[model samples]
Target: MKEGNDDEIWELRLYVAGQTPKSVQAFANLKKICEEYLAGKYRIEVVDLLDNPQLAQGDQILAVPTLVRKLPPPLKKIIGDLSNTERVLVGLDVRRV
Candidate 1:
C-alpha cells in the first residue's frame, strides 16, 4: 500500500437505507480497506437514509450502501457492499487502473 501524506485526510461518506446485511457488509469492507490503505489519514461518515431520507439528495444517491469519496477532490461514487477491494481502490482513486 502506498503511504498518503499525513496532512491530507480522506473524507468518505457512506449512504445506507438501514442496517441491512449489505449495508453492514459495506461498512466492514470499507473500514478494512481504509485501515489497510489509508490508516490514520481517513475519516468515514456513515449516513443512514432511513433516519434522514432527505440527506440522500445532497449526493443524489439512488442506491443503498453507496460510498462517496467526499475529499481529495473529484468526488466519486461506488455502489455495492464494497467487498471488492481492487474496485473500491480504483473507484476511490487510491490506485490507478
Candidate 2:
C-alpha cells in the first residue's frame, strides 16, 4: 500500500552471509518490524551472500546482516545484526525517533 498522496513503494534488501545466528536474529527482527510497521506495504528481498556472493557488489555490501532501503531514492543501508529495532526502523524510514 502506498502512503496517501505518494506513489513510492518501500523496497528493502537484506544481505546475509548464511544461516548464522546473527543472520537469523536479523531476519527475525526485521520481520517483526515489518509486520508491525510495514505490514503489506513493503517488499523484503533477503539475499544470501553464500548462495550468490556477487549480488553484494550491487549495493557494496561489505558486511552480513546489512539492511538496505533501496526505494524512494537516496538509498540507505544499515549494517548490523538487527538487534536494535529502533535503529532498524529508523534506518528503513518505517518509524521516526
My TM-score estimates for the predictions, one after another, are 0.95, 0.86
Per residue, candidate 2 scores C-alpha lDDT tens digits across 1-32 of: 21332446678899999899999998888888
Alpha-carbon lDDT, every model: 0.93, 0.82
Question: Per-residue lDDT of 1-84 in model 1, one digit per residue for the tens?
Answer: 754456889999999988999999999999999999998899999999999999999999999899999998989999999999
Candidate 2 lDDT score relative to the true structure: 0.82
Clashing pairs in 2: none
Clashes of 2: 0
RMSD of each: 1.1, 2.6
> Cα deviation in Å at residue 61, candidate 1?
0.1
